[model samples]
Target: MRINVLQHTPNEGPGSIATWAELHGHALFTYHPYQFGQLPTAVETDMLIILGGPMSPNDDLPWIKAERVLIQDLLARDVPMFGACYGAQQITKALGYPVSKAPTKEVGWVPVYRQSSVIPNLPDNLNVLHWHEEMFEIPTEATWLFASAAVRNQGFVLNHRVVGLQFHVEPRQNNVREMVVNDFPYIKGSVLNQTAEDILRVTVSGKNERALFAILDYIIE
Candidate 1:
């Protein structure tokens, strides 16, 4: 299968998703709109993966708008899609849902409770890395999947083909470090926010990879 990824930043690339695709013998392609200002003209791939970024989907940037249009196109085509963080917000906004500021800026490793058993093998509670100030409202047509204490709309699934997660489950140790270094300014001293040292100290475990792969498999199955 041809799996296309829309990466919004250099730091936030498809980490374990690429590994999963390689293991499954699927061709993976990634487009960088932040650097090249280019995106797929149509749904040419079997699946789409949208990675996280520092920007908001509600931003007035031309590329952000274009990306949303592409997402809408994919939705219309019923293309299987997986979006993380800002990517999730983009999907929600494309679905005519509002993306607005959360009650607090949730950062670092936080626990998200599974609200539905739609994706098998997911634990009831999982601690995932989060670094988003904005939250996506669950679309009326979508099923709510997960929620965190700081954000109620942590995840949602639409038509059993599209999954949107508001946390970073695909980030490797190096990816997290690079994100901390590049987007460190966004971190503030809040109850939910974590210090750079603390966030880096925690090891990236296999549980995250398993959950991410499970979600990917569920979407494409």
Candidate 2:
């Protein structure tokens, strides 16, 4: 299988997604528009993984606009897609859905609930990493999968292939640390936000990793 990852920032890279691809011996490619400022051509991707970033999909940035175009092309072909935080926002915008600022920011280890879906036996509550101030509505033709106290549209699946999550189920300790350092100012005092110390204390357990892999398996298989 071929997996193409679109990463918008230096700190935010494929975490468990890369691990799963390597273990499965699938071909993996990445395009960092922040550094290179060039998007990849829409090729035949068995799975398209869009990693999270701090940027908003509604930004006036040229690359963000270009990414929406690519996302539209992939949707038209019915290619399986997995989008993280910012990636989720992009997917929603591409589908003509609204992407707007949340009433409160969601950072650190937050909890999410899985809605009843084909993916079976998901726990009632899941603690996953989060670092976003924006939120997206579930797109048309997509089934709502997850929700949180702060955001109702935490995750959704479109055509049973394209999945988007507003939180991070893939980031390891290193990834979280990098995000805390690079985007420290976002860690303001809030009911939903947590301190750096609290964020570091949150463990990357096997449960969350397994949930992420389960989603990936569903997407690629």
Candidate 3:
């Protein structure tokens, strides 16, 4: 299978997703729309993974708009897609739902509770990394998957093929370090936000990676 990834920043890449793809013998490709301004068409994408970013989906950038259009096209064709954070917001916006400011800027390791049993093997609650100021609204047709105390809409699943997570489940240790280093300024002194030292101090466990892989497998199945 040809798995295409849409990355918005250099810091945010397909961490464990790439590993999962390699283990499954699938080809993985990444496109940096922020830098190269190119995206894969639906025909070329067997599975689409949209990574997180610092930008908002409401931004008036040309590439953001183009990516939303591509998302809409892919949705029309029933292409399996997995979106993280900003990518999740983009998918919600593309589906004609609203993406608004979250109650608070959640940036750290937070616990998200599983609200639906659509995807198996997910624990009732898991501490996943989060870095977002805005949240995506669950579409009327989508099943509410997960929720955290800080954000009500932590994740959603649509059509049993598209999944959107408002947290960072694909980040490895190095990926988290890069995110903490590059987007350090975004982390403020909030009740939900964690300090750089604290975020870095916590080890990146294999549980999150397994959860991410499970979601990916569920989407493609």
Candidate 4:
């Protein structure tokens, strides 16, 4: 299976998802949106991944609008898609669902709990890194899979194939380092309360990667 990754920014990446994909022997393709060109071809993808970015889905940029159209078509095709953070928000908008500011921004390692355990494979508490200002409302037609203490709708699944996660499951060292650096500007005042290094030190080490791989494994297979 070919796993195509849609990256809306230079810094965000597949992280531990890459490790899992390589281990599963699936071809990984990445569409870097910042490259300034048409979206990459997806004719070969058995699954699609819409990665996280700092930009809002409501941004008026042409690329953002174009991506919305493309994502809508992908939904029409019913291709298996897994989205993270901003990507999840984008999917929410494209699906005619609502997304709004959460009561507060959730950053660093937050505890996401299994809502109902219908999947029968997830844990009661999952500590995952989050970096998003917005949150999604579970589409009326979809089933919510997880909820974090910081946000009510952490993730949702559509038809057991398309899934959206509001947290970063990619716990690779590079992902953590890059996010800390590039995301600093958005986290300015919050830094006074808690340093990025301190947050990283606490959140970076955990079994989150294994749980993330399990989600991907379940989705792709």
Candidate 5:
């Protein structure tokens, strides 16, 4: 399968998704919307993986508008899509759903609970990176898949084809540390409420990455 990746930044590129794509023999391609690029003309892709970003879904960015249309068209055509954080918000918003500031910004490794779905076949609580200020509404046509203790709407699936996850299931440790160094400035005001030491403790739980990829693999399958 050819998996197209819509990247929002350089560091938060593909992470485990790239790993999985390579190991599984799926051809990988990328579109950096931050650079105002076009979606691939190739339709050979079996899945579309939209990565996370620092920008909110409501941002007036040009790529945001273009990708919104692209995602909607993909969904309409019944193509498989899996979005993370901002990507998930974009999916929900494109479907006429709403996204807004979450009361508590989930930052470190937090457990996401499975709702009424086959996801319960996995662990009861899998720790994930929560780095978004905005949350998405479960599309009226979608079914809730998972939730976290801090946030109720962690993820949802529409017609079992499109899946959106609010948490970062595939975070690379170095990229996260770098994010804390560079992108941290933008989230500093609200993120500072939690100590850097505490964030480190939770995020460094390396075992979470396995479960994260497992979930992603399951979702894509």
Candidate 6:
């Protein structure tokens, strides 16, 4: 299978998802919008994976708008998609919703409460990496999958093909380190936010990693 990964930044590449694609013998075509100008076409990829970023979906960047247009085009084609953090917001925006600022930043290892029965073998509470200040509401036709105390719209699934996750379940240890290093200004002592030291100290447990793969499997299958 061919998977096109839309990366918003150099640091937030497809972490565990890249490992999955490599191990499963799937082709990976990555586009770094920060460096590269254009997004991928649906005809070129069997699946689309949008990774996280520091920018909001509501940003005034030209690429951001183009990415949303690409998303809508892909959805029209019924291509399977998985989005994380800022990517989730992009999907929500493409679905005709507004991405707005949250009450506070959710930046650390946080628990996301499951809400939908769409995802099989899901835990009631999922511990994942949260690193965003913006959130989006579940789109009109999408099923709400996860939520947290800090944010109500943590995840959503549409037609079992398109999925959006507000947290970073696909992050590896190195991915976390790079994100912390690049966005250290957002770290602070708060209810949801965690310090760089604490963020680095927490190991990437196997459970969250498995959950991420499971979600990916479900979306593609």
Task: Evaluate all candidate structures by whole-model CA lDDT and list the values in order.
Answer: 0.89, 0.85, 0.92, 0.77, 0.76, 0.87
Worst 10 residues of 6 by lDDT: 185-194
Error of 2 at 14 (Å): 0.5
- Cα lDDT tens digits, model 3, 93-190, are 99998899889888999889999999999888888899888999999999999999978999999998999999989999999999999988888955
Tens digits of per-residue lDDT for model 1 on 72-170? 888888889999999999999999889998888888998899999988999888878998888999999899999998789999999989999999999
Worst 10 residues of 5 by lDDT: 184-193
Per-residue accuracy of model 6 over 1-221 as CA lDDT, tens digit each:
99999998887888899888988899999998867787887688799998888788888999989999889999998999999999998999999999998777788888899998788977888788888888888988999999989788899999989999998898889988998898878776446656889888999887787888888889888
How well is each residue in 1-221 modelled by candidate 5, as lDDT tens digits?
A: 88888999876777777877788888998988787676754355578898898888898878788888888778777778889999999999999888998867777656787776554345666667778778999988888878986678998878767888898877677766766666655555454365455565554455556655565666566
Model 4 lDDT per residue over 159-203, tens place: 767788888877587778788888776655431245687656765
Q: Name the best candidate (by lDDT).
A: 3
Give each model's clash number: 0, 0, 0, 0, 0, 0
Instruction: State the local distance difference test value for candidate 6.
Output: 0.87
Sliding window of 10 residues with minimal summed lDDT for model 3: 185-194
Weakest 10 consecutive residues of candidate 2 by summed lDDT: 116-125
Cα displacement (Å) at residue 162, model 4: 1.0
| Greater-lDDT candidate between 3 and 5 | 3
